[model samples]
Target: MLLTSRSLSRLGHWAAGLLTGLVAMAAHSAPLVMAIGDSTLFAPLQLAAQEGFFAAEGLEVQVIGCINGRRCLKHLTDGEAQVATVADTPMVFALHAGHRFDIIATFGSSSRDTALVARTDRGIAKPADLAGKRIGVVRGTSAHYFTNVFLLVNGVPRDSVNLVFIDPIRGAEPLLRGEVDAAGLYRPTGPQALEQLGAKGVQLPTLRPYTVMVNLVAQPGLSQDTLLRLLKAAQRGVALLNGQPGRAHELLGARWKLDARHAAAQLDGYEFRLSLDQTLLSTLEAESRWAVREGLVESRAVPDYLELMRVEPLRALDPRAMTIVK
Candidate 1:
């Protein structure tokens, strides 16, 4: 009787284990997530995907690379993607257009990662010098905003410079070939431009710390549970990227085929502040105010930017990790 009872107990334990496995498998079969972004955002997605971080969280992510923030917004608006990594300007535009989305989190925080590159022969050493010159910039992008602010604050009239719209990825080519006098490009591309054409670039000094370039946005009505899972996974990925940069660089280099020095330099200058910082909030407020005054958005209809931002997941994962303003 004792032996028979022990065998039955063992069988029951196996049955419970099987039940748990089934439940786990069912949870893992949830709908896949779609992510859209440019190269900067794409790198982390690729790393997360390659590292099984998403899968471990029971998420299947489909990452698509768009040319710029505008295209990223289009992808989200067109229902081509459910989530996107973009800049503050595009997010503001989407909010004004009445798109129901939330700024989930930010990856980069500084403008140092981006620069205004000019031909060495052009003798363009400062933001003011770009006046009256045709500068290639992706209109409606963070780069565009930076360029506008840099010029205006430096006493360069908005009308003094001719603005030309160009794809950020291909913007350098035109500038290198003398099609445009200067180009606004991110670090990776900026480094590539300097290496390829020996172009000189100037980093703009702005009131706010030039960090927080990329922000992760999600479509409205994402279930709280799902959003929490994604935030957790992303936080995990961010921790990896920040803590183990060499491994991060290795992964990025393998995918982008970037040289070690360029990749390291890009990583070094990038401020991947996972949590929303005071500087970012202040910058967003200032940018929004500027946008309203400059007729970018209706002042009366300006939504509470804080409402459009969701940081609960980050707070939930590690309460001490983020210092939310309010």
Candidate 2:
């Protein structure tokens, strides 16, 4: 029998209500995240995306490549990316410059792969031997900050060294061709530079007494639930990296053109974690103070270092959720 018009109207209403409910659930369920960082941090994102960890967390994440610290900070402040990796120095500077960002977690802290490389012919033996020599560096970057600190700590005057601004990727060429006596670069860029130019180099210690290599940061407005999901996902990714180095190496090689051996070596040097603990907090605060004293930040605008950190999400997650890298 044919349905009456009244029945059809009631059926339409039911369907509409069901559709609305479904849409609301989807909206509340999946959070969108934007990540920006150097090639190293980008490696895990590529792997995690392939492994579906973000999907498991009810998140839709967009990972973007940003090598420059200043540009990454600008993208984050302009709302182009919600979560990004920034060097500890630039994070401190951004805080003092009045941009609002929250540090979600610390991932990598090793500076072992970060080096001050020189052409063998340049006759540069140590940090102190570089006086009156031109050194190529990415100005206003972590490498640059570290280089400056290295000079000062080694009792080398700022004026005694000549700094040439250049892209870190292309820096080795200038050094190899005798354009500069030395170049400051971070791995795998540092490794690539040494391999390509067949140049001899010396690894430098952490420039600042307590400096972190990179940390995850988010915009100020993410909901607590969303933040928690993100931290859990990231922590899971770190665990995955530690347990499956071979797979992690393959992922890095495919996405970032990183050599498997080199990638594995780099990962081996780091102890990955999702914590922004007292050591990290204290280290960042001390570095920020050093920046202010060194004129990297305005003396009067120093924000509380703790204010820059947001660790509740990581703390809320079960400790069993993370894999501690040995």
Candidate 3:
């Protein structure tokens, strides 16, 4: 049917309005690149992405997987990712390197996450046995910090053992190839390494030396509104993790192809919660000192960790989550 000029004009306006709405939606959903470590420690973030929590928060998140937390933070520094999942150790190193970012929230933590998997054949039956032997560790990571603390706790001097810096992506390959007697690894890697070693490997019996704080870091200028939305989404993910742990594990195992037993063990070791607490400050301070003392980072005064944290976002999301005194 032929349309009147007035009708045609109305139709044009409707079409224009429809196009405008579509453009606004597209802009709103522009994907935010989140560089995340491929480890069980980041279960909350991973779950949030996989379970539609991010989308539910009206945030389009595109995750870039890195081999370790250090690399994940590196992506943030290099501008490849707007946000990253990193542990306290990497944050300390990144601070030392003058890379500025804000710790938005700590989503997970575990004392038993990092361990030394020693080859029985290398006479490394106990933690002390690591003395004078080669130990493989991922440099500039929680595994690296854990290795030092583990040795010190076991009465092994840092200089006594030969530290073989291995690639984070390689896990325990150096140990598997007999290049190192033991490998300091984080979960999934630690379990996989022990499994691969069969009866030939043993994890040293040492008290938990380090509690890695798995954190979400934002680029320096990330808006508080965006941060709050991200944290809110992660809070929902944390609720899923804590409330229905079995379902969370099932989802994680399916998405990451984790062994059922390994997934359960990994999940059990972690406590997923959203917080910006004093413990996080204490851990960052301790890690900073350790990094400098161990010559891991160049000698420099520790940056004010409180300054590095952006607590307002978490506070705005949930006041209880912001326990950081400052």
Candidate 4:
């Protein structure tokens, strides 16, 4: 049927009103998240914001920098940030301290991300040689835990070594200057230190059980809608990272001042990812035990990990992708 002028005008008004409503929904529904992720090599949350992944998912994510998981947790607890990317070790401490958070997603299991780097010239040709040597480590971070576990597994006594607590970012210098016999460091700085140390540097083995899984967490009271948006954005961000690593690396280098090639190398070792499952919860429970023994936490009872995980957001997207919440 042919439309008359009056009907056509009515049709235009309806179209305009519908367009206005859609815009309003996108505006009001989009959650403004003050999200902090890895400050160094790890870059999922940063990539999402840079690549427009968050915007595509209708989320307004503000990326901030924190030195490590513990600092990220501090940002969340201090109300400086709404969401954060933290690892299991510090989370063990935070939880034991009575901070309530809902871990919405897990990033990945990475081995090259953290390690114990030693200077061969310090007469430390082996992990056991680390005994009586001064070691630079950042306390309450993954490297700190890795250092302790590495020493334990390698049969080095804690009392035999002198632990010098220093920031990971500043670790490479001290090792090069012979200020510390070795340094416990993670990617970027870790790799860079080894490169600078050349044949003089040695990478000791890492404890697989300590599986430092970087996770996205938020206050327990975070709205389900916002959590879902974060999940959507994170999934897309991981896809892009894997699908076109060159472009991702270039962007990361230009924006974050990281070397593209080094970033690519770093990315290979990490699983820029998303998950809320039994595998992750099981890991946390195991870490809790280790944490308590290491004096990282005082809780004799492992907080029921399931209570801290909010799986509905991830489940809503892909039930098969997430484990059944018990």
Q: Output the number of the lDDT-best candidate.
A: 3
RMSD of each: 8.4, 6.1, 5.8, 8.4
Give Cα distance to truth, residue 308, candidate 3, Å: 1.1
Q: Which candidate tops TM-score?
A: 3
Lowest lDDT block of 10, candidate 2: 317-326
lDDT of each: 0.70, 0.69, 0.87, 0.77
Return the TM-score for each candidate structure.
0.81, 0.80, 0.89, 0.83
Q: Write the per-residue lDDT of candidate 4 for residues 169-216, one digit (tens) a residue.
A: 565898888889999887667888999999999987644434578888
Regions of model 2 farther than 4 Å from truth: 1-33, 68-70, 168-171, 199-211, 318-326
lDDT of 1: 0.70
TM-score of model 4 vs. true structure: 0.83
Q: Assess the local accuracy of residue 41 in candidate 3 as a C-alpha lDDT between 0 and 100.
A: 89
Residues 1-326 of candidate 3 have per-residue lDDT tens digits of 99999999999999999999999898667788999787888888888888888889988889998888899999999999999999888888889988899889999999989888999998878887888999998888898888888987888988898998998767778889899999889988898889999999998988656788899999988778788889988898899888987888788888778766557877776888888899989888888888888787875789999988888888888898887788
Better of 1 and 4 by TM-score: 4
**Local error of candidate 2 at residue 136 (angstroms):** 2.5
For 166-195, candidate 1 gives per-residue lDDT tens digits of 866575788778888887776567667877
Candidate 1 regions with alpha-carbon error over 4 angstroms: 1-30, 199-209, 296-300
Clashes of each: 8, 0, 0, 0
Minimal lDDT window, size 10, model 1 = 203-212
